[model samples]
Target: MESKSKKQKMSALEQLKKFTVVVADTGDFEAMKLYKPTDATTNPSLMLSAAKLERYHYLIKEAVEHANKVATTTDEKITEAVDLLSVLFGREILNIVPGRVSTEIDARLSFDVDKSVKKALKIINLYEERGINKDRILIKLAATWEGIQAAKILEQKHNVHCNLTLMFSMVQAVACAEAGVTLISPFVGRILDWHVANTKASYDSTNDPGVISVSNIYNYYKKFNYNTVVMGASFRNIGEVKALAGCDLLTISPSLLEELENDTETITQKLNESEAKQTNIDKINIDESTFRWMLNEDAMATEKLSEGIRKFAADMVKLEVVVEDFIQILGK
Candidate 1:
């Protein structure tokens, strides 16, 4: 039995877990086990890194073999292989975590609602065929106008939940909630990096642009009674994590998870739905044009969204190359 004072020395990670659903933002199974995250998120970039790990090397090989049987051309094989790899990673991560695993659609489909919807459904079907129900998976899409529209369709028609990623602006959050998307993962570290690079100014946890962005969106969602889950993601440091301690969810990297485990700082709940409801906030929704204009007005959000999409797409391309190279080797 442990004494009260001894248990009081709980690490910041444990403390934060008390307030928010701690999510492992990595594709590494060991990391998810290390932190015991409730949920997990993976994008092309994370998946690309994970697919290359020696421990998980078999996944890409498996994908390559399956693709080789079904695909006729290098381009077709690469696409099929990557898609299968995404679901493979999702399945493995789901087995490790008790909650949902987010599997993203290719970022190249970010602008086409129909293609995004089709690709998302294909991923979900792949998971379902593996005996994993749609309930335990989130079809992650970019938070573009088209992506949000596709999410709405998935949520309403197919009963498949969606996780809107690359979210940066309040307008994006607002639009996502209005679309009845299951969740939105706002990029916290990327926002902070943008501010730091351009402004050449320092930021503490309290006034960190990333922290403030998530907080504002959290409060707004609570105020308006939106059911969309606000997940703060892509964290740079533990301070940013500590500041959004009470967010609905936060996807944190393994490196920062280690930092939280070592620090025994007191974690406080900063944002509460009850408090937000009592605060003054206007009911708001963003139309397509308004959404575009508002997003354009916010330079940080605009730049980050485009850059994020490009990065994800580039990773997808790189993953394709790996698959193609592996396929060529097998042909020898």
Candidate 2:
């Protein structure tokens, strides 16, 4: 006979798949296993945090040893170290999750289309050499105009899949779809953060700018039959997650995943194409000049985009320092 606790405990994975693809947006492999998310995502910030934990010590040590053995220069060592760390995390994540894992390129290269594409391909190759198939990896890059263009070439020419990150507007989403990228991660919490600071008032999910942005993107993709998957990311609260109940995917944090798991309340569908057709939303095609001008005009978008990049870049540097310190301790 099943215990009351076992009977009452609902699976977050089951509820998550009904509305959106469940993605574990963390670098902690043990936590990821407990939730059993379908997919997983990692940024420099999450990796830095994970490396600080005692449980992930071996990953840093191994990365340093690998770096010392094969790298010809300091720059090469850093690159090799980052690649090794990314693969270590990816391998650990694959053990827990059944779907793909997103490993990001350096944020500092977001504006350099060619460099971003090359780096992405490098990371994918590293994973491949380890016997991990390409299908289970999504190269995560920032959604700069150049980044999208790079993704276009990578998809059409190289046959590599991508997940465009730090996306905020319709223009970016439209460009990604046209580029034939595999997925786009529209940040829900970050958008809400912009709205709250600008409006100076608390916002509700139904009418929240962030919630509406993702809903619009999801509907647009579905309406036009774009195969690009829209995975809503950077969630601040459960309300934002609930608001985007029907997104193609939602990469949520473990805390919110826990909340959803504990509650047994009914969840409802929010956004769909059938409803989208009823609303009047004009589709706009964007060129490089227009895209830049539009981004320049929107202070919130411009500021948030730059801020996100800097934060991620800083985290990457910090992670490198941690790796170096770990190497010294390991004598490699």
Candidate 3:
């Protein structure tokens, strides 16, 4: 009996869960119900994909009607409606998962700190009105300079937790930690995407840029005693996901989640607080200039950050168009 129990405990998914929080990266509430992740994250792209499914079409209608009740102008109505839609999807995912839901603001607002803060607060209010606790939400922002700045204020003053996303550089991670944000999502797959495109080379998990990116951030945070959680995002394959087994959190796609569940290979811990503390690294201050300079020096980070923002912004526009068409059909 004891030997059987020990063998069962050796499953990769179970062992990985022992140290890190698992978050589902999609907006699909039904799938989340099955996988039972500790948290869920949604961006415009994910929400748009979910809204297209006939099962979730009602959420789109509900958001439009909900927005029309508050705003007067056509533009205002569309804007408010999109915000409501983001919250509505988040609310549904929250119901399935036992933990917080991270809903992103518009990617176009990534550079406008003030606008991002206002948008984040409004989303919080929308969720609150729906009877969800504030603590059960994280307003995901881009890891741009402005976005990081806005998150600091939102965390310090408004008591709103922030997840700095689209992070591809160590400098960005350092800045986010300094800002005292709730979490930082270092995109592992996107980092891999950039390297593959430029070098046209394949990499195993050991040397994968994506895996190395998250690992560096994770080690740095632990070494410096930062409270910000590091969540590895945008994994391209099971190897990329498995490489980051001991990350603070890893938001994975539903497809990848299934891979983890089926695999019984032993998952070993590669990172821990004690291990991080023993490694010596220089802690440096990153003001705006240093942050910008460091990012410029790294080609992968520079290209990937811009590319990520553009892709998300494009998806945001597409989602708005969908909402616009839906509203036009309503003839309001």
Clashes of each: 0, 0, 0
lDDT (C-alpha) at residue 60 in model 2: 78
lDDT of the structure predicted as candidate 2: 0.86
- Give the per-residue lDDT of model 2 (tens digit) for 93-118: 99889999999989999999989988
**Model 1: which residue pairs collide?**
none
Who is ahead in TM-score, 1 or 3? 1
Candidate 1 residue spans exceeding 4 A from truth? 1-8
Residue 11 in model 3: lDDT: 55
lDDT of each: 0.92, 0.86, 0.89
Please, what are the lDDT tens digits per residue for candidate 1 over residues 1-332?
45666667989999999999999999999999888999999999998898777899788888888898999998888888889999999999988999999999999999999999999989988888899999999999999999999999999999999999999999999999999999999999999999999999999998899999899899999988889989999999999999998899999999999999988878899878898788787877579999999999999999999999999999988888877888888768
Top candidate when judged by TM-score against the true structure = 1
Q: Summarize candidate 3's per-residue lDDT along 1-332 as a digit string, tens digits.
A: 97777667555666678878999999888779877889999898898898788898898899989777888887887898899999889888887888999999899998999999999999999999999988999999999899999999999999999999999999999999999999999999989888888999999999999898788889899999999999999988888878888889999999988888877777877778889888778997999999999999999988888988999999988998888888887765
Candidate 1, TM-score vs. the true structure? 0.96
lDDT of 1 at 288: 100
